[model samples]
Target: MPSEAPVQPPPPIKIGGHCFEWGQRSYVMGIVNATPDSFSGDGVLDPAAAADRAARMVEDGADLIDVGAESTRPDHQPLDAAGEWARLAPVLRALREAVSAPISIDTAKAYVAERAFDAGADALNDVHGLRADPALASLLAARELPAVLMHNQRGRPPVGDVIADVRAGLEESLAIAEAAGVRREMLILDPGFGFGIGPQQSLELVRRLGELRCLGRPLLLGSSRKSAIGWALGREQEPPSTRAAGSAATVALAIAAGADIVRVHDVREMADVALVTDAVLHGRRRGDPA
Candidate 1:
């Protein structure tokens, strides 16, 4: 007789109007960069084009659509809240008219989040994990909206282990969210790939992602077209569009590692990768020996 496979956890909790079930099936959150300088070269200068791309992503199997105005790429100049809102507001409005998938605002500024939410964003993906603006947690708590708390290490770490560092940062952020009255179930944790981690550190986190799952919050892996992919593929000069296959590979790996949500640029391809990987890793076979 053969041994049984380990049982995966239940799907992610449905927050607001979104269901983020994990393990059962991987969910893809498509990226919609509303800026002209997006590293992925997918940003749409025209609001109509942005809306159309978002609608296409929804039809292409995206479970969510993440919209951002500023480029969070390394060395990119950050935009002010007003500037960011100016670029994002039109896209968000247009998307609301075009697609039904929940909209997530990728921002750190409370002002931007507030405006985006009012414009129909259902969730918040704070890269700074609420550390940049302490008031953002309160805002989320008040709105009862789901927020992804990504572990960021903008400063020097006291320890050398990236996993330990990330765990600590996430715990601290979760504590802050709790203190601010945010619902525990409304929180999601991300390992913060490429935010302040090097290529080796990022890989190690992906390998040890299961440890982060112990935190009990849904784990969101945003390794799509990230700098770490470029480093691993030995294509430092290549753009994000060139990293699609690499990103798809990571999406599959991340799903196997127990990631609840995958933030990705190439939604259609990554969604297919997630489905196939999930079938292999967790789906039941009809005639396999057990």
Candidate 2:
């Protein structure tokens, strides 16, 4: 036998020039933090520099680049739509010129999303999962763009276990999308790894990630240099750059458990991790026989 239970690829999502054939192999979404206060310490404030960084990530094996101007770190300062757009415009413009790969704008504001689309962004990644801004879903539906609706528990207390909490949060996001006329095939689900959960819950969330498959959408797991990795290493003070090995471990495990896309800062390493993990679980290579 080739392997154990294999991934059932969801309907392909075509963004820009790429079609994400989910189960063919794990996909990598490289993080391009444009904020000066980004938690990963890889944020580039200059538009030109950020674009160069994003292009390098693509050459290193990124399927998509998620660019964000706001810092999502806990208790980070908030940016209004105008403020956010100001930070994103130049970076997105440069990114459009620098890379042909799909660009995903990681923002929850309808205003920002609209401008981003005009600037050549191919998709939207709402960490609030359509819950923060009522108009965001409408924008997505109207634009007919692909989106990542993540289950975030930043302010609300969890409902139950990690799996249950994530499931419930994502369901509400799905409901919002459906009501807004967004196509189901254009959506992806992300179980927020470090947003509002503790270390144990985060670990358990990944362990049982497959259970969320019942939601009937592709899953995106992003634990790239998140605080949970530092917690897992028992050194909560460890810097983000020092957590690559732990992030790689989570990437491999998540892919085996049915993750379709992995968002990461260490693109080259995690890309290799996803490729090897896919080969192991799927039992095939680029040119290998069945």
Candidate 3:
């Protein structure tokens, strides 16, 4: 019998003042969509309510909070810069007062990212991988904030092999980031599940996620309540709230495959899921001292 390969631990990544020691523990990023049209259906209309939710997520063990003002679901209408800023400003301000965890702004617009960073967001998660606004790469570089460069092929057909295509695309994005003066330690790569992937491709990505760590950056998986789950469950038309179990499954699998961070909406439940998955993968029993 062949010997099993040794697991490769991800390198530590720092964003703002937080240090994420990947492979030691899985970090959790809670979602806070502040728009009415979020595909996840958890958007809060009130800024105070959003702030409260942020506090609850932190209490529930969220290592970070990702606040988004616009809907990025396929075919969703895009919000203007001013509109996005208006929706995110109050919530960002409120969250600043509520939690100490690093906050990330999910936006493709450079202007929106600038304002959010100015208003206290510690990171930027650009779904477009800085392609939507080339200037965003420069903005992230200038601000010296860590950014997630997700692989998104919005208008293309599924590539013949999902993982290969994702790796190629992310390599290009990394080149762009470097050209913009972003440091290698400041980059996080997301495979962009459901952004352009079909059901099979999404599943394969989760199953083979370890391959992505070869890129040498911390891996962030954001499969929470995504459409890919609905597709896999034969409920593509169902609401996001109904996909918790599937999301949990992905979270566990992602951790097993070497994901450093799991971004989720069901913070409390998924945090528990990450804890158990980490214990199993790393050979630590539950309640063992860290």
lDDT of 2 by residue, 1-290 (tens): 12222346578989886888876778999999999888888888898999899999999999899999999998689999999999899999999999999999999999999999988999999999999899999999999999999999888887678888899999999999999999999999999998898888998778888888888889999998888889989888878999999999999989888888999999999999988997888688744776
lDDT of 1 at 31: 90
Indicate whether candidate 1 or candidate 3 has the larger lDDT. 3
The residue-by-residue lDDT of candidate 1 on 5-35, one tens digit each, is: 1356644666547776655666788999988
List lDDT for all candidates, in order: 0.83, 0.90, 0.87
lDDT of 3 by residue, 7-48 (tens): 655467776688887668789999999988889888896889
- In model 3, pairs of residues that clash are none
Name model 1 segments beyond 4 Å from true. 1-12, 285-290
Decide which is better by TM-score, 1 or 2. 2
Tell me the TM-score of each prediction against the true structure.
0.92, 0.96, 0.94
Native RMSD of candidate 1 (Å)? 3.5
Model 3 per-residue lDDT at 252: 93
TM-score, cand. 3 vs. native: 0.94
Query: Clashes per prediction?
Result: 3, 0, 0
Write down the worst ten-residue block by lDDT for model 3: 1-10
Candidate 3 residues lying further than 4 Å off, grouped into runs, are 1-10, 285-290
Structure candidate 2, residue pairs in collision: none
Which order, best to worst by TM-score?
Answer: 2, 3, 1
Arrange candidates by lDDT, highest first: which order?
2, 3, 1
